[model samples]
Target: MWDNIGSPFDYIAEKYDEDFSNSLAGTLQRNRVWHFLKEEIKAQKPLHVLEINCGTGVDAIWMTEHNCEVWATDVSANMITIAKSKLRDNSAVNCHFSICSFNQLEKRFEGRKFDLIFSNFAGLNCVDENEIRKLNTAFFKLLNENGRLTMVLLGKNCLTERFYFALKNEFKNANRRYSVALAKLTKDVLQPTWYYHSLKLTKLFSSFVLIRKRPIGLFIPPSYLNLWLNKHPVITKLATWLEYTIGSLPIFADNGDHIYLSMSKKITAK
Candidate 1:
């Protein structure tokens, strides 16, 4: 979906943060995702981070503030420009953003070794399983001993959500995007493939220690918050309260839009 769209994220880059920095759903989703991620960062030594498809630099800024050295990259030049602008006024002097995709990693960062590797929002889905599987070999050489890799991946539920969203919005142009995504999900076949399964994701990366999996979302909702924010203030308030109240409850965490995975590199031949 990413390569086909060539950074549709660029279409919303400037206002991405503004879209949901304070909404109940946004706050709850990010809070859960980052909170779980921070635990791993805190457990390990101060490390360098390599974030693939770093969207608009929001996460990059957060990482820098938490004292991690950040090298953020995306395939979109426009997204990189936005990231560079966000870094302009920040104190994460250790941060840098660039335009590089997974296929181009060797050409751009030939000898770089990172203490951690990160990507957010199902960026790994942008590539195929075979290619993504190949990264273990590439990253193994690039990671310091016992480094960690963490990311927030979009879940299969997003497809159904998108379907209902398009149906609710009733937009004529909605199906165009939906069809494209569905096609990608099927890979031109009859079946669909989502990027991660909490258990299977842990298994796929089992060459490394399976640190933990925390499902995000499971309760709140997706980006449609703009549809309900002002019309029903009291209802919104109640919803917001419910979100925060249940954000950390294991039963409710993964119901949102994304999930967090924190895995550490292992030293052994398994």
Candidate 2:
């Protein structure tokens, strides 16, 4: 899916951080993901991490600050350029940025292995279902024994999004992610994207065993609804609290705007 998209991200690279990463909803949503990531990295200590679709290198720089050796990659050269600029003043010798697509992982880093293979915020959604399943083998070859693969993917079902769109009587738009959809990236650009349920993603990486999984934006609402959320700070706080209360419940875990999944590569007896 991403192969044919031809760098649609290039158009948004300059404003991505300002429009989404630094926005209120993005900050709140990312804090949830970082909470889990920090805990996992702290437990591992001195981890070697490979981050895919590392747009703007926000997480990569943070990992370097925590003493992890990080190789951050993105498919878009423009995104990679922006990421490099962000790290230029940091003096983080531990972090490296490169332009490499998900499909190029095997060819680009054939013998490299990492303690953690991480991709955040729907980056993997750019690929088709078959390509995502193929990642099981690619990741298996690149991960050390018992290493972890942690991904944050857009979920197939988001109750809040459905309700929001349904309120506008746009049922088709509400259900757009039920399978594959052509997501509008900009006014004139559309990219093929896929939303996966937790079970479906797990099945794709059958060689790995699930260790942790949770919902993000379960009550927080998707970023597109951020304008309303920003205006209603009290409601946003309540939603955050509600997410804290029920986000991990099995019934709610895969129904959020995005799902967080962490799986460990199974040890195979030689």
Q: lDDT of each structure?
A: 0.65, 0.87
lDDT, residue 55, model 1: 71
For model 1 the local lDDT of residue 9 reads 54
**Model 1 compared with the native: what TM-score?**
0.75
TM-score of each: 0.75, 0.94
Clashing pairs in 1: 215-254, 217-255, 217-256, 218-254, 218-255, 218-256, 219-255
Error of 2 at 137 (Å): 0.5
Per-residue lDDT of model 2, residues 1-270, tens digit only: 123334889778888898889888898889888978887788546899999999988999988888688999999888888889887555357899999999999889899989999999999999987898788999999999968999999999899999989999999988988877888879998878988989988898988999889899899888888899999999999998888788757567788989999999877789
At residue 158, what lDDT does model 2 achieve?
A: 93
What is the model-wide C-alpha lDDT for candidate 1?
A: 0.65
Q: Per-residue alpha-carbon lDDT of model 1 for 47-109, expressed as tens digits?
A: 788888887777888888887888899987777886788765554487889888877765577
Clash counts per candidate, in order, are: 7, 0
Best by TM-score: 2
Candidate 2 deviant stretches above 4 angstroms: 1-6, 88-91
